[model samples]
Target: MAEFSTNDSTNFSYPRSDYVEIVVVRHGETAWNAISRIQGQLDVELNETGRQQAAAVGDRLSKESKLSVIYSSDLQRASETAQIIASRCGGVEVVKDADLRERHLGDLQGLVYHEMAKTNPNAYKAFVSKNEDMEIPGGGESLVQLFDRSTSALLRIGMKHIGERVVVVTHGGFIRSLYKRACPNGRPAGKVLNTSVSVFHLHVEDKWVLKMWGDVSHLSQTGFLQSGFGGDRTSG
Candidate 1:
């Protein structure tokens, strides 16, 4: 895994405090996530396990820090997760933004990986190769498109918050894109576990320093491991 370091400067002025913190939380597990389906742009709700994950996330955040604002993807899963966090953090209003939605999977929207590999070998290969230039067979987004839009949305949010501590609930792909930009030399070091929390401190110094990534200490008691699409759900 790649090593990461934190910024130690206190000379920057954030909108609210000495440091501006942005916490990124991935939404909990969903039926699609459990069933290995391509859930991109699908408005799926959290299952019972998902709700429990959200509750655990909420409890963890409530005990750890105070948040100024909570934002989330407009999708039901992300929105619901944000709501849980907001409720735990003093009933703060939750803001939903479409820009935070997962990358559109196009023709691959509902197919599982094994199915896609058998039915659309070319598309499967391109996807696995992480080709930024490859487009989805039907109408899926290229990696470049997802990166551009997601980063733009994040910049807009960062500008608004400036120095405030905010929480953003989004999908694994969205968070991965952000991490790639923040650490462009190589792939992000860790997996984005379900309901995992990562912290980034955006500074006026024109740098985004990662404080933590994929922290799942809170889920230890739950005995659940991170699960993703493309395989049977199981502990990691």
Candidate 2:
């Protein structure tokens, strides 16, 4: 195992003050993650390194946040990551929620970027271009739908547990959507890292503030962070 240091730093301008904090974590890697395949709602399990990353995130956060409850996507990979983190959090309750799952790609599930392009060039192009309203050919939700659904769920969570700290384990696409929603004026945030922690606070004014994004120190410390996968087309 690679030795990791506790350095959680970022370049966001979100203020740190008295408010309800929510730690948003993108689930650790899976086989599809390495290959840049669209998992969508496929329920793929995490790989060995993913499990290690989950443990690392759990270890890192146990001392960092005053965790109250854990909300996780019902998908296997995300649920597994939440379980690991909860185990490290001294038995924090893990609640499964399908709303936190990856955007359903409909028929695009399990396909890589190249494959998707060949099959549905227009939809693939629109998705790769980050067309917020582009819909997949076979019953897929657009990026707008994804952001609306996931953020709404998170907003409810924030409202229900004011002044409390919680952890949400979910997928990359949904993570990106929520971040985009929180920082509407921000530029594209590139990739949503596996096992990375993004923090948001529910302000007294009831607005969502992005405190941090893609803090991958745990994965870096544990040597689980890697690169070189092709870009995602459908972004599921």
The per-model lDDT (C-alpha) reads 0.73, 0.76
Put down candidate 1 lDDT per residue, 1-236, tens digits, no spaces: 22245543223344564346788898988877877677888789988788888888888888655667888999999999899878877897799999999887766677875587787776666566545877776777778887888778876787678768788999877887777767778553556777988877766655767777777777776645445541111112
What is candidate 2's local distance difference test score?
0.76
- Model 1 lDDT, residue 193, Cα: 73
Model 2 lDDT per residue over 1-236, tens place: 11112234332223344456789998888888788777788878999989999999999888775688999999999999999999998999999998888887767777785587797776666566657787776777888888889889888887777767889998777887776777777777677778888887766575767777878877765564454121234333
Report the number of the highest-TM-score candidate.
1
Model 2 is weakest, by summed lDDT over 10 consecutive residues, at: 1-10
Q: Give the TM-score of candidate 1.
A: 0.86
What C-alpha root-mean-square deviation, in Å, does candidate 1 show against the real structure? 4.2
Model 1, stretches more than 4 Å misplaced? 1-3, 6-19, 230-236
The CA lDDT at 23 in model 1 is 83
